[model samples]
Target: MHDIAKVTLQNEMDLILAHKRSMRLAELAGLSLSAQTTFATAVSEVARTCLESGKVSYLILCVNTDQRDKFIVACLKNEQLNSNRSREGLEHAKKLVNKYNIFTSGTETAIELFYYIAPHFRVDLEKINEWRQLFRNEPSISPYEELKRKNEQLQDLSEKIQKSEAHYKTLTNSLPLTIFSLDVEGKLLYANEWLERYTGHTIDYLNNSQWKTIIHEEEYATFAVLLNKVITQGTATIKTQARLKNKQGDYIWHQVSLSPFRNEQGDLQYWIGFIVDIHAQKVVEETLKDNIELKNTQAKLKENQRTLEKYVDELNRSNLELQQFAFVASHDLQEPVRKLLFYSDYMVSNYSGVIDEKGLGFLSSMRSASHRMRNLIQDLLLFSQINKERLNFTDVNLNEIAQEACQDLEIAIEEKKAVINMSGFPVIAGDASMLRQLFENIIANAIKYSRPTQAPVVDITCKQNAGFVEIAFKDNGIGFDEKYIPQMFRLFQRLHDRTAVEGTGLGLAICRKIVEMHHGTIWANGQEGEGATFFVSLPLNTPGN
Candidate 1:
């Protein structure tokens, strides 16, 4: 099952929207007009029940397929209800849909309705995509309808506020912070009890004096400027810090924020403001500014720096030993394989008279296996050695790199009759040997994977981007699906079979390591049977050069 559309049922209007969307999707899925209405009505009934529970619910329309049938599925869930609070509504909706099921797990309840598509009607990814686009491009509600929706929402909000007005006042009076509201004309409308007790001023006195008796004189000037700007512009919310005189006659630091409240038509209605004491935070800041405390912090930071450096040194030493062991192990393991290849050749040349064809073939297979093992070990050693610490940067010309790579693959290019086109090479700072290897591996793969019926063609192009140079190697070969791109660059991750193409599967992996060492990137693009292009982007100014 795949969800194509989702709507949150927050109010009555959302239920209406859900119903409309359900009918549209059903029609798009090749349902009759009557069937569309029936399915849509069923979904809306369940959605209404969930919304009436006084919590937000979700309705997701999905396309699900089984072996023999395709279904348009609607899943409506409400997490606040554990039991079936609308059992009758569910039964009614169930009768309208072709199939229905209700699932309950702990506090969540989900109802799934399925409308099976007729066998003659077609449903596929392309059709599903069309349905999604249609939903996004659906025409907006008419102006009259929109106005009615807004009016309904406003009425609901008004009723809620009226019912909760007493509780709201009690909650604000018990809170430690100050809450206040102002009219559009900047007149003081109301202030909570906390503000009055903290400042030892009544609401009437605050209104007459404009709170000058409570606000510190030094900060009042800045506060007034910001407040007047908010009143005149009525733009975004603004927050500032000021010192307000308390009942004990101490000026304490407080954070004040003023936000303009707008009505449905986007007209500024009034302002809401809050003030919270932040005297303790200000004292902490002052303490941190002291020179002695700053020096102590610096001393601790230096100690941590030394500890981190010590650990880094130990890690580098361990890495060096591991790299050396890999080199030594690879060299040691190659000797026996080399000897086996030599003895096999010797037996084929000197003992041919005593051996049967089957025995000769066995020796041939042993020699082949030995050679592959030798190549694998060599590739592994190269892959392990290409790292940032070992990189030696220089002013290298990429044209030379391309030429060298082509020279290395001269035999394969000639065998495949490959045409190599190169142009727009640039000079950049990079490791010479590694860059050459990068070009060689990619170019070699281009030739090796060429279509058998056609001669191979490899195009090498370069472009200079901001602070970097991008080089692309495009090949007319038997390419791969772009999805296999990530897999192809991983060590021992190959898209082609060993019998079809011969390599250790570490070529692209090594290329990536070399690119990363130069603070660069490598990627490729291709389609099956169409060919592929591999891009390597290197920085013009190499890091640590």
Candidate 2:
């Protein structure tokens, strides 16, 4: 930490200051002027990268004595590690001086330079001050050297840009759609190979403003007006259909889309557009239009009516068989599991003297597994029944439904010392039994997953938006990650381990299906260890509407 100079990259001006400070530190380490210049250039480049990334950077110079020998070091640290190019630049600079080291701690990257100190040199205070002043007052590089360096850098940059452009050109040419770029005034700046090939024109022939001649005469005026509007307003409304002249000597239907790209200041830079040929789709659409009055065609209706009836009959038969199978399967599956659980419990109770602790534990595990299996089957049966049952919809009072659910869960609420909160509710068009089931299951889960040794709090809220009533159930329990919200309402998708939280993972799915049947929606949001909120939106309008 001794003999150190530090500066942070705050703005454009700080970049040069950082370089000059590093140069002074290098000169104080008894390096030649060439070494100092190399050090300054490397630092300036690193600073420029930090500035472009809009991150903070710190430059420091210090003395290190922990190595085999004492040395002077310059370190540049930022939130990110030195990029490959930056490291390469520093490596080349090291050839003109001593060694360089790179270290990373988490997200922070540090580059340290250990300078080659002259054998007999000790840090002279006056010399250090003079070098610092020189770096502070004058340019870090001589005019001639700087001019040569800038020219070399410019040449290398130009070559890289050209290589990148060629790579992109190859990619765009391989796509089937036409890709082109336009300036602010609607003049074409570049076009991919597909565009040139489809139009049967060379880049020079239909280049710039000349490309407009290839547009279909009927669509030219409208297309031109839209292009001008998009460029002026910077809007996505430039997406529309157009007829374009192709190499086949015919005008083909194409879907043209213009996406505006902007600079850092949010000002429009240019428009990147794609023209995709959709002539086949357009033809199919035209055919569909001719038969728009489907029911009026008596011959077509008679032909389709018989086929549709047969399909509907088969679907009804399949649904009936599926529901019957579910009922039979759940009953059959529960028997074996129930027997195992019963026998295990009986043996544990009657033969405790003959059974060891390990044997009892195994019996306990069997009981748990049997119970879990029974729950899963029951949940599956309930879900299938809800789908199969065509229940009547009525104007059900949600407040009454919520109260009934709470009453059903009174035992659990009392055990968990839970408090349920709800002021008022809405009367919405929905199936009463399904809505009651939804609230009961959600409320039961809230009490079941409450924080250990803490009283649980559940809040129910209802709101109206236009013709929809949104009911939300929020709980102060061990909530799950919001990232898994999509999976939350999916059958057999569990976020927590069964050992910790027992669930068949069908409650939310049932709720979603019920809401969807009523032409509404359901969703849940939560964060781990915080709480969860489940929303069920149902329409206020009746089913007949």
Candidate 3:
């Protein structure tokens, strides 16, 4: 009983394997049948065969392929039956396939078998063929039809764009100012009809040729340079004056404003600009400038005339005061000297023997004082009259003038043993006589002050400046304190004792006045016991020198 049970389990295993092989073979053959029906049929047949065979323990069928098509294997408990079943089933199926012209295979086991339908016959061939034929008969549209529809839509869009462009052009042309654009290469790209109408050039000519030729010759090169710079810098706005041609072929001054247009990437696409005629404004500005200049000139002339009249009146008043001063000084100065001279002559002639030595000495002193008083009065008169008269200026060489002054003072210079050094004096415009007098007074002072020195040296030198000449008179002598320089130039302000320096103390005062009258200045610098230098700065060409 145990052995019989083991054989029964083996037979059941064979049937299950055979059924699995049949399903696998069908799948491999690409069968389109429902899995439920195929599985039920294969399993039921295998079960019935297994129950009838008591000797069979188990059976199984397996499928294999060798290039062309699928084949099946059957396993059975009876060795003979299992070996012949596959052959017999294969032959029977082959006959069926050959008779029906179908590509298929089938086999069996002791309790089970398998049958396979090739891909060509396993599926629903009639339905598949009908689908393929229907696909072949389908219709297609022509390429031109689709393209024509797209073209129609594009044409509509193009028409709208053209209308919008025309409207923009109309608005731009209606503007009062001339508007135009230039390409990146500075060639005229687009211009409104207003430009052609105003400039007397057709749109074709303006766009094809260089716009610079239409610009005035004087402004063409400048405009080209500026426009090129604007493009190179990517964008710029420039206001420049240019001469633009009008419809009548005449040039008109225009103020042009050029603003560059650029793309989103900051590349210069073109320049847009406007031109406005400014000839009327320019003419008005020029006329106003001329009128203002004329008014300023007239005002200046009037002011100058007023100043001249005031100067003339001042000169007359100064002359009158000078004459009065001279007269009063001469009269008051001569009275005391006349009495002293008369008394001195009477005392000397009548009491000559009776008077003692001291009395005689007193009379001699009186006579000397009288003579000095007369000389002082004469010098005062000369000083007052020096600049009271009119000045006559001419080219006067001071070298020659200084030589003459030296000659005039030859005797005094000789007596004092004064050595004068003079060189390189400039020829200046001045009154010859006044210049001669000026040199005489300064040279005489130098000689008188140098009396105490063993070798009296007076050096005279002249240096030329931008508008004046600086003359230096330096003397090596008994110099005074620098503190007394200001007082020295004042009348009757003597620095030395009366007995030491014999003069009315009026010589320097006269020198100052003479220099000032010639529009010059005089000052002195000195240190005690060293020397004194007088500096005179005279204008090179003063009206009265």
Candidate 4:
């Protein structure tokens, strides 16, 4: 096995060396000759050597001219002729002769033997020379002529590009906005014709530091900062107001926008920006604003005058009504009280011994009812008067007011076993007495309605927001439906049956009125089975006070 491996290695080496020598001889033959006679002789010699060495079985040579005006030549072979070495040798020699340009038509062997000495013989050599001369005399262009034509086309394209760029500049300069470009270092690079016209200067003058010099000194710093930022960020746009020197040498307001232009590499090469004349727009806007402000002021003055007149009329009417109501209440209520006293006195004095227990009970009930009627009339008078008066505005501590109100209703709260939870509250500017009444009414309602519950709980909490304070009173009592909420705050409006609850229904209405007068709002949220929470948001300060 080792001996066989050595023989195989030696055979491979011999084959590679033989192929290299053949390629070298082909290269030498291709360079040294151009005419067919010498070219054929060179190739035939290499073929003959290959055949004698038995390296090549069958050989064929081919040659042609490429587009580059250079020759391309190759050799081909058949390995099957290795079985008949003599035939392979003869075929290889004939194949080389067939490559001769003069011997164009023959079998491989005939052309090889004929062309070998025919070049030196008069008959074959004379004919080929005549054909070569005829072909050489024909007119034709060289490969260099084709490349020259392509270069002329490229030159024409470059001229068209330059003309298009000139047309683009003409269009850009015709715009109304002043267009300009600057390098990253704030040097003026390009300015449109409109800029020159606006500044009453030439393009050369505008391209220098003249543009910067024309910017108002007050805006220069800000403009510089923004310009630098635009370049640093690679791309940016900003609209800013600046004062620019016009042709008349007067400063005019202009709206300028600067934006960075970047190349494909994302590097900011320059900034392109525009400036528009905004003096007219700016003046119009300022005038409009001033006019609107003046109109608002005049309207407010007129409204105030009208409001004062209405208030005066309302006050006069209230005074007259109060006077009439006072007269009727004093005379009518006194007459009923006097009749009841007189009758009680008469019954006790004249029929004391004759009166039975049932008759005495009836007399007592008559007196009690009459006295309750008198108290109700007095409460009604007070309610009417409260509406007629104006609120007394001052900074009032709502927490303290709530505490005081609860103390006044302490007996009722304790007897009903009602729990009142009062928490954080804010100091609000309002009439102290009205706030007290507001708390009193809500708390009293909570206690009164909670009588049926096993453990009555009333939670009072307050929260102060940006412009108002919210005081919530939640009660676990007989709650009313949400649909009745709109009517709940109307005077004399009642949700529960009169026989079930004892109230004139004036309390909530008064609470709402007081809150509204303070420029605040009040609402109730509850379900039928659950309890109710009344939210009152009162402004910290009263309006028009």
Candidate 5:
């Protein structure tokens, strides 16, 4: 576009021709008619001044052949043009084109008029040359036409400004936020309806410095600090949270964003900002924080519970080991006690004549004590071993076990003249060896606690109910009070004296232990000087059930 052409402005005729040439060139370069007229008039005035001053001047018209950045430049250039530069004429041309600039070198002056052509428009050098020739010989207009064009341009600009303001107001009002603008003096010159309605404040509050009253007292210092930053540092964008009093006089949480606008000279002229209600969002945030804290607490509690469970498990295991050791140690002690009884019996038999009668009586007492001590130790061992040993469960016919127990007690039965009556029974899941021992102990106990006149009649009966087999052993015995039922299964809990029973009290306790090991129950019912019935319930399934 810097390519230049010149025409001598020798007189009004030449000036007019140069102006027409500039007009036609601008038109061919795709300028609108108004732009062409405004630019051409300025050229005419400048060229006329040059001709009247008797200077060798020319009108320089340029056309850029580059399509991407195309321009058609018109200028009045040369040292003599400076003396005839129509200042008022150039000032009026400002509204006509995109913009213009003046350049001077030494004594030379060039008023460069920048006229735009569409970037994609193909440059037609041939058409441009033809138009240049045609307008070179064309006529010019008077000052009346120029004045009319200027007035029309001014009127159009005023209408555009009014429309722009209306559009801006409509856009800000349509938004859901509270939009406002602040001037350099921290005065609110404009605030949208949303801002005024939501805050219950207007421009009057800003003028009287009462705007701070709408902000929560707790946030006044914070808002003041931020406003100071906007005033001093000229920060373009800022955001902060504050509680603003609403129209109902209730404080609502809001997030305020501000952006400062600057003029062409890069001085801050206005601060455009808006307030967004964030009360609900803040509440949700707080709720989420509490939930997180609660979950963490629950997790910690679960961890503590797990640690406690492990500790309890360890304690149970240690107790079991100690019980097993006691059983083993008691079993080892039984061997010595057995030998002691055997040696005492031998001395009493062989040395009865060798020693005196008193010596024999003392030997008899020693043997009785040793026998009692051995029985006590054996009962203790059995009780401790009950929980110490692993149980292997299998189907056991309690009837068969009861029959075998009766056979084992054949001597005691005949000696006591006991009549054992056993009916048919059910098979159940349990440790077979333990069930055999349980039947033996319960039947033996029935025979042991019997009245001498009754001849110790024992009746073993069973019934199947639910998932268990209930077996009851009834005896015509000298039964104890029913109030002592709970203590009847406890070790060393004897209702009859040792001199009458001639047996340890651990027998019933061992029976209860065996029943419990099979996941079953044992109990007794009785009346004084009447009879006692011991019941055993064994599960039909595994203990886990």
Candidate 6:
């Protein structure tokens, strides 16, 4: 590299220095007048861009040689990365120069413009140093002449700026979007032709109203707030969406973005904003939102179903364990209970003669206690089996069920002298054995809880209503308080004294389990001292149906 001259670009005068140095270097290298002017103008364009950034920059004019060619180069460099503000000027300079290159490293930017030196020109290091010495020793011009030169340069720069501004205006007007600018006080500085065409308002009107007339009334307040916030702060970039009314009196969605344009010193100059149509994108987003919600709802339902299936599997496993327990209780436990009852009965029958009256009474109590224990074990086995096995449904005559239940409890009914009244019946879909158990437990309860003063009477009646077979068992027995209704169907929830009623307290519980398995309902209605009526409603169709 052979040094020609270097100038610091701080003001308009520095631009002149760069321009003059570029022309003098080209002339010393034997360039024609036209080429000198072109090179000078290109260097001036780049220098002006650097100066406009409101920061100090350097313009270095030098001659560089490569293996293949020798060249004169003008390189403009800045310490700050403000290349975006200099893009237009750089592009203009590129058209005038033979070759140009731009580079950035960290916060610095360098734009190098090159012109090839003709091979025939015998330029050497000694001649380049002489040119440099001439510039250093050159006499200063008179103050008047310097001022006149500055005015001519300023006039030429103003003409170039006007032409650039006209070119940008035409380019923006040809585009499909609305481009705008605003001052720090929210005053309209400039608006493109697209804005005027879309809003059907001239730039003069927009300047007076600040384009607020074209924004939808519903969003005007929000838009105003955003504009005011950006103007007040003058340091942030904000983006928002609103309905902008078109010339056809239709409001369409548009996205608006505003950015603060600042100088190198970080002072706010103006707000640059753009508006683009986004009605189609907004519609798609809304549609996707609804689809997302629907998918979420479906996902929740599937999750709930999976959870329910998990619970059902656990219930099935628990029932299987209970079934195994029932097997053990019936076989292992019943044998010992049977032996106890047998020995107690044998003691009473064989030793009554040897035993005194008090001893006989003790033996009799033992026999009775063993009998109660046997009944309790049997009831427990029945309770465990209900949930363990699946129902076997068939067409069952409820009349026959009632009759079979009565026969099963004939001994107890005979002992109580209970009167059983039969009424019309209906054939329904149910598990025959479970339905029989349900009836038998209800009848036995009626016979056991009969008032000591009256003979027990049970009337069994059935009728078809809706899709169900409704059966009512009206018993003239000692009724219970209605408030205990919730507890009446629970296991081991006895309402009467053990001495008064010989019960295992599991009869009603087993009945309820059977009714539930068949998808039927059972409830009792009665008051104290009044006879109770138990109503069972079984669906006519199968349980699953």
Candidate 5 Cα errors over 4 Å, as ranges: 1-331
Evaluate residue 7 in candidate 5 and report its C-alpha lDDT on the 0 to 100 scale: 63
- Candidates in order have lDDT scores of 0.85, 0.77, 0.68, 0.65, 0.77, 0.85
Model 3: per-residue Cα lDDT over 1-545, one tens digit each: 00101112234444443444344434544554564235434443534344444433353333333335443333233322333443444344333221212122233234323344354543344533443344234232345434543564588799999999999889888887777776666666677777778877875676565565578989887676654744446446877887888878888788877787878987776778777789788777776888978789889999999999899899888878878878976887688888888988998999899999998998898898888888788778878887645678888898999999999999988998889999878888888887888888888887777746476789999898978999999998878899898798998888888888788888888888888888889999988778789999988886542
Q: Quote model 6's TM-score.
A: 0.45
In angstroms, the error of model 1 at 267 is 58
Writing each residue's lDDT as its tens digit, candidate 1 over 441-521 gives 999989988999999999999999888999898998988998888798899998988888888898999989889888899
Report clashes for each candidate as comma-separated counts. Answer: 0, 0, 9, 0, 0, 0
Per-residue lDDT tens digits for candidate 5, residues 452-496, read: 777998899888788888888898898879888888888898887
TM-score of each candidate structure, all chains considered together: 0.45, 0.43, 0.40, 0.40, 0.44, 0.45
lDDT of 1 at 178: 95
* Tens-digit lDDT string for candidate 6 (1-545): 77677777777767766787788888887889999999899989888888888776898898886436778899889876366758888888899988998899877889899987784656777777898888666554557436644675688799999999999999989889999987777777798988878889987786678567889888887678555744457458888889998899999999988888889999988889999999999987887888978789889999999999999999999878887889988899899889988887888778889999999898888888888888999999988878525688889988898889999999999988999999968888888999999999999998899999999999988888889888898998999999999999999999989998899999999989998888889999997788899988889988567
Relative to the true structure, candidate 2 reaches a TM of 0.43
- Candidate 4 local lDDT, 182-251, one digit each (tens): 7787666778777777778765664465457667999876666654644446446767888888788888
User: 2 or 4: which has the higher lDDT?
Assistant: 2
- Candidate 6 or 2, higher lDDT: 6
**What clash pairs does model 3 have?**
10-57, 10-58, 11-57, 11-58, 14-59, 14-60, 15-59, 18-60, 18-61
Model 1 lDDT vs. the true structure? 0.85
Which portions of model 2 show Cα errors greater than 4 Å?
1-321
